[model samples]
Target: MKQFLILAIIVLSIAQIVARPVEYSDGNDDVLAPEPEPTEIPIGKYLLFTTKANWIEATKQCRSKNMKLISILSEEDNDNVVKVIKAAGEGRIGFWTSGNRRKTNGVYFWGNEKKITYTNWEAGKPDNVRSNNGEEEQCIEIMGLNILKWNYRFCSNELYFICEEPHESIDETQPISLLFAQQILTVQMFGYYENNENEEVLTPEPEPEPLYDLVKKYHIFTTRVSWADAMRHCQSEGLQLVNILSKEDNDNVIQAIKDANQGEIGFWTSGSRTNNNGTYVWGNGQPLTFTDWENGVPDNLHAHTGYGQEECIELKGYHILKWNDHLCSYRLYYICEENTKQNLFSK
Candidate 1:
């Protein structure tokens, strides 16, 4: 009877083990499972304190919730926070950011003492005490009037503020089940398993090819024409006279000309003198912050015998792509700017 009881006990233990769920670890290389969806944060990830408070009080408010006032570290992050603020429906209202100054004429620092590497200050902003405004304008605020631009404000000034908190991210490098691994492999071999009900079918737009299959964002017009005539032609062609915004833009323009199999020929750019006589501005009404003026250029001398003021600039392509003042009516090769985002081939 005792022997029979022992056998029955062993059988009961085995049944219990069979009924329980089975767990396994292959001890293989640490492979990552698919990441779970991110958890949503309250106040839509970034919270805004609409209540008015001094900078010190604002810091406290954020610290109370284990968060810091928003630290914009990247352009993408800045844009995303701006979107969140817009969604908050605050119509053209300014709010405090985390950038602050501790000493006069000192660099601003983040609230959490993180290094400040990125800034999107408005034009002529952070001009502390420029108009004898108190030197105490050490705190930074996002001026809604300028749209995602920062400005210096007095720390004592009561204003709304933004805050951010850390979120827990799960480690995706955890092992997945053999069945899931097999399914993933199958999907990789084939295409993704699609459900027609969930997948929206739509025709994709055709990509626009570069001009002459050579340069992107620009078309070189080898046809000689005066600056005014070139501008008119570009307008008629839904283009604009080239505006060299940076060194990269300058290089690309030169490359486009070369790609067109054109030799070094001075091309008329949109750069022209303003009524101020001295101040030059781009055709797009942008400031002349960048320039590639040739040596002793804009001497404003007229062609042959210095008859009239040279009010226009031309890309002296043969002379190292340097710019020289030229008569607007002088005939020369020119380049036209293309809007790359548009499909030029679209019907």
Candidate 2:
């Protein structure tokens, strides 16, 4: 019996070895597609606010911001983008890159071009899920920089978002608080004769206020108003504070109110962090997205692993003064801003 078993084991091993095929060429090791040649993008005048938006939403959001989706050029460009995202300094993290694979199968293609070359996917990513009926997945997402991983999710998941604009576009008439330039209020150089032997240098028009600051500019904050009360005040005047997005967004709010109020006290913002799952959803009912959390904060009780659990909140007065978690009924002096988009930046 022992001899027979040994002979059988050897036969099985030989059969297994014979069944496997070895490729003649080592070329299989050279799998990744070459990175593509990048376009000569203008000095980026605009730094897009990243969003977790799927393809459709991303496109729409970027357009609303008077911009478009980012287009990746080379691998080095990807690396630089990662650097800018990290340097943003908001505890809240992640930024949309110019890469997405929602169109071609398992291919990371640029939104604005063709000729895909470079690839920066995490290990075993772009699995490209297939259904029993033979449906193919076309959407992909990248998260975390240290080891950026791409995953296939529904096209409508409303993840983060990315915006793109020519560097020259930023110098256009945007608001100051939105983009910080010491000379934000200074005169424009374009078409202006500084040292020209012509007309005197006209006071450069101030860049338009950032969307958030502009919104707040048209708003008025009252003291110790309940959430409902605040909402009512805004509604009465055809205003609503339901669209805050980034930390810069929240900060913009505080800054507007503070500057407008002068010695006024702290008020409640329409933004909020969740006490459940630590998923920060803003007043728009969209997730309170963005990597803008100040460190050691938004603790969300630290119960949901590292992510916290506070949602539906208001920013503190003095412009994004660290946020707080309070019952909405606590009757805090709250803020109410008007949205002119649904109305022209009106009160």
The TM-score values for the models, in the order shown, are: 0.40, 0.35
Number of the predicted model whose lDDT against the real structure is largest: 1
lDDT of 2 by residue, 106-128 (tens): 33444442324766666676675
What is the lDDT of every predicted structure here? 0.66, 0.49
lDDT of 2 at 265: 46
Model 1 collision count: 0
* CA RMSD (A), model 1: 23.1
Model 1 local distance difference test score: 0.66
lDDT score, residue 91, model 2?
17
> Candidate 1 on 62-90: residue-level lDDT in tens?
66776667777779878988888777776
Where does model 1 exceed 4 Å of error? Answer: 1-216, 274-276, 303-307, 342-347
